[model samples]
Target chain A: MTEVATFLFSAIRVSTPLVYAAIAAVITQQAGLLNMAVESMMLSAALAGVMISGATQSALLGVLGGVFFAVLIAMVIWYSAFIMKCDLYLVSISMNAGLVGGTVFVMYLATKQKANTIGYIMSKTVGKLDIPILKDIPFFGEILSGQNIMTYVAVIAVAVTWFLIYKTKLGLRIRSVGENPSAAESVGINPVKLYGISFALSGVMAGLGGVYMSMGLMSYFARDMVAGRGMIGVSAMNVANASPAGSALFAMLFGVSDTIANYMQIIGIQPQLIAAFPYAATIVLMAILAYVQHRRYQKYLAKKLSQSGFEI
Target chain B: MNKVRKIESIFELARIILALAIAYGLSLLCLILVTEDPLEAVYMFAIGPFTSMRRFGQVVVKFIPYALCGVGMCFMYASNRFSMFGEGAYLMSGCFVAVVAFLLEPFNLPLLVMLPILLIVGGFFGGLIGFTPAALGAKLKLNELVTSTMLNYVCLYFSLWILKVYLADPDITFFASRLLPDNVRLPQILDRSTIHAGLFIAPIFIVIAVIIFFRTRLGFSIRICGSNRDFAKFSGINYYKSIIWAHTIGGVLVGIGACVDLLGIYDRYLWNEITNYGFYGLVSAVLARKNPIFAPLGAFLLAYMHTGASILNYTSEVPIEFVQIMQALLILLISAQTFLRKTKNKLIFKDSQDAIMKEGKTA
Candidate 1:
């Protein structure tokens, strides 16, 4: 029972960053932008946040710095993609590569250390929350009691994203722009501005994800540490059809797989092979989701035809 | 009419120059902010490659694999699919070459006998990697981008496994394969530089790619399919066959590039991660606007920048990665179709109006 509790706790902890990234992906994807540069934004933010926090010794300043850097990068992406009319995928890929190199370059410039890591700097880490009432409960409490503040922020973000996306005026405009930009423009909504806003919001979420990586998970920045988590989150958003709650669930599923991979490492499995499991799971899950969506669309078509009294 | 064509070509040249200037400007700004000796850094970045014969040779050596990868990527981009399996194919092909070269060492085979077999095996495996994504897309409707990206990681891990289990040199502390025999090593082209026979081989493939792209029915079908799938279908082109062939050819090129890079640069296979030559190739292809004819130029430009960056790193406090930022800015600026579209349109419109007026006056 304790083992299961420990596993669940670790899973939740691991899922926090994915949850943040998925929410970010959901926002931009719903706004009809292929924001492949989220990984870059997260990486830049992670480095900026850690560097700033290390200098200032303030976690709040670090988080804010991270978000600011991320939003700045996102705006650059938006400007390049929309205003300059560059291919979004190419721009994002270039930005991703740039950020990877930029982070390492900056880290080396700052510390004259190895480009692979910036762990030596005594940066501030986000404190974990141990809820009093939750800690007193049983195995369930053990799973829920102590987690980083970013984990709570991630949970709140899901609800906030759901509300902002489904229950607000701007949400409607954003969705309209995604579904039919011409229609949105006809109704006096500037699709470009809305898309820009969505990108900014996505940047905030991705920034928080980066903060979680550096401050919540580990108090240091590593080169390419986000790995393919950004891609995994994008896939989660795809599998969830851009729903905040659904993406959160999928993120947790990935988190579970990740936890399993870590546990397998304890049993003497090769770390390299184990590292590939989450990516493999993501591919399989994406295929299954695509198949299911296809079948559902077929069923919906059949039902609609029958209702309209048309022969199959 | 001749004047208009001249003006248009001049404008095209200006666009590339403007993009490159802005990219360099930004990189200079970064250097000023970061380095204490900014002028020296800038000088190194701009003129360092040409200052030495050795550095110039390094640029030539780097250009070989990059150009091959670029040409390979041109096929896929021309076919309108972004199959990123070139990265995996490069890695896997390198592994395959190491394994084959090691196995063939016992026989003490001559370079003539071994090289062709190595190329064929490398190309076959790489093409197989490329085919998997294409087949998956054709049959299952999976997104090639995601599948290919995942396959890159899969290939990396699988290659690592092969290295650790089968080919590892126990004498070395780090993960690396046994060194190839002297007979199997690529013969150096230059007396003092690392430039090898692979530089010659790279151009042959480029010529073949040029021929295949322009003088073949399959290439025509792929181009047509890429431009308009519905139109291609209406015109009786086999969409799946064209796409599969394009991707497979791309994979073969990258695979061959990997083998060349391995033989030219290293005595043993020591790559623990994706070579990233495939990504650089992709960048070269993009910069060439997916034109096979211009891929070598694009590859040369990238290789030159890298050589400059390495020189800058050697000369000053600036890191080599500063070139990555410059490359990214250049790509973004150059790829931006709308950047100077209004000016271009205005020039063409004015020229056409002038021509029309001339015709009216003559009549």
Candidate 2:
């Protein structure tokens, strides 16, 4: 029971970063752009936030500062795609590289550290809130109650994104742009503008994820600290199919797998062989999604043939 | 006298000169910002390569594979797909070839017989990995960029796992493999430089790639498919077949590059992560504007900066990791410009603007 409880806790903590990244990536992808810059965006936010917090000792500024810098990066990518005749993938890879260069360049100027920041930022971690009656409850209270502000924000983000994507006019435009930008433009919709907006918003979300990393995973900004979360989010996005609720669920599942791997190391499991498991799982999920898409495509063709009264 | 000629000449010069200026300025900026005596580090890192015979040799050692990968990537990009078969080829073929080299190096076979065998096996593995996305793209008409990038990571993890489980030397705690015997080592150039036969091989292959890209029927089909794909389909160019060949060629280059890098530089293949060499090659291709012939020059520049940055790291406080970051910055700048220019061409805001101009003239 205790092991299960600990695992569940660890899962949520790990899931927080993935959830932020998945949501960020999904928003951009749904707008007909793959935001590979999310990695840079996240890193930019991480460094900026920590610097702000370190200087001011204000956690809010840390969160804001991170998102602000990430937004700036997203804007550059958006403008390049919208105005210039550049390939989206190429632009993304470049922006991601630039993010590292720009940040590392600035890191040295600000702190004189090469690999990481020089200061120790002790920004406040999100305080946990326990409902009085819920706290009295046996296992339910312990499992459900305590999590950081980002956890709450992530939960709310899932609900908010679901409502926005399925129920709102903005979602309609986002879908139209992704499926066929030419057609979207025919109806007076600005596909480029939509992409630009979606990408920036996605950057904001990814920036928030970086905050969770600094405040929850560790207390300070470090070099490449987001590690593979950006790519992990890419994996989760495949599973989610850009659906907010699906992404959150898969993000949690990924977090759980990560938890198992982390604890198994305590029991002397080989870190390396087991290390490939999450990526393998992600690849499996990608293969499964492809299979499902192929099947659906075949089914749609078959139905269309029958409806048209075509020969069998 | 000729407007088109003048514009072309100007833009061409702008491309090369501006790029170099950025590179030079960047190094200067790093030196100035990171160290008190910026000139000393710059001189040591960049100019220092030619100052010593040994260090000059080191540059040659690193230059071969970077050039090869860059040229290969140029072909892939020219096909209008970010297939990036280089990564798949690099990891799959390099790891397998190294294992074979280690196993065979002990048999005392003549180095001549062994070298070709390893290179072929390496190139074959490279082509094998390339076959995946080419086949997938032909069947599903899926986006190649995302798929290829994702696959790179998967290949990295899979290779790392194999390296750890099967190939890692059990006697050593460090994540290195059993060093291969010296029998298969490439003959080096004279004492003036560390130039190996691998350096010569890169140029030869690149010359062949240039010939194949321009002169051959297969090359024509690939180029046609990239430029006016619909026209190619109308002409029965077999777009799918062309894509396969393009990626296959790319994979072969990656394989050869991996082999060259392993033999020319390090004693063993000891990568715990993706060799950014493949990525750097892609950057070279991008900078070359998908020109296969020029790609090697681009690759050389990138590789030189990388080597020079390491050289810089010794004397300056600036980290070599910053080189990776700056390279990324250069990529983003070029990629963004390319992406935006593509968008403009596709939309032709000019067409609409031209229409408005015509109406205004009539009014």
lDDT of each: 0.86, 0.75
Q: What would the TM-scores of all predictions be?
A: 0.94, 0.90
Model 1 misplaced stretches (Cα beyond 4 Å) = A116-120, A295-312, B1-9, B228-241
**TM-score, prediction 2:** 0.90
What class would a CAPRI assessor give candidate 2's docking? acceptable
Candidate 2 deviant stretches above 4 angstroms: A117-124, A129-135, A267-269, B1-6, B137-143, B170-173, B332-363
Q: What is the lDDT of candidate 1?
A: 0.86
lDDT of 2 by residue, A135-230 (tens): 677776666677677788888887877777678999889988999999999999998889887888898889899877876667766766776677
Give the distance in Å from residue A90's predicted Cα in candidate 1 to where it truly belongs.
0.5
Score residue A188 of candidate 2 by CA lDDT: 100
Instruction: Write out fnat for all predictions, comma-separated.
Output: 0.60, 0.41
Tell me the fnat of candidate 1.
0.60
What is each candidate's DockQ, to 2 decimals? 0.59, 0.40
The residue-by-residue lDDT of candidate 2 on B1-363, one tens digit each, is 244455445554465556566756775676777777877877886787777887777776777888888877776777776665567679878788877887776588987888899899888988877777677667655445545655676677778877877788887778878876686677776766767889777888889988999999988888888788899999988888998888888889888898887777667678776676667888888777778877877877777777787777775676666676566556645544452334344445555667679899999
The numbered model that scores best in DockQ is: 1
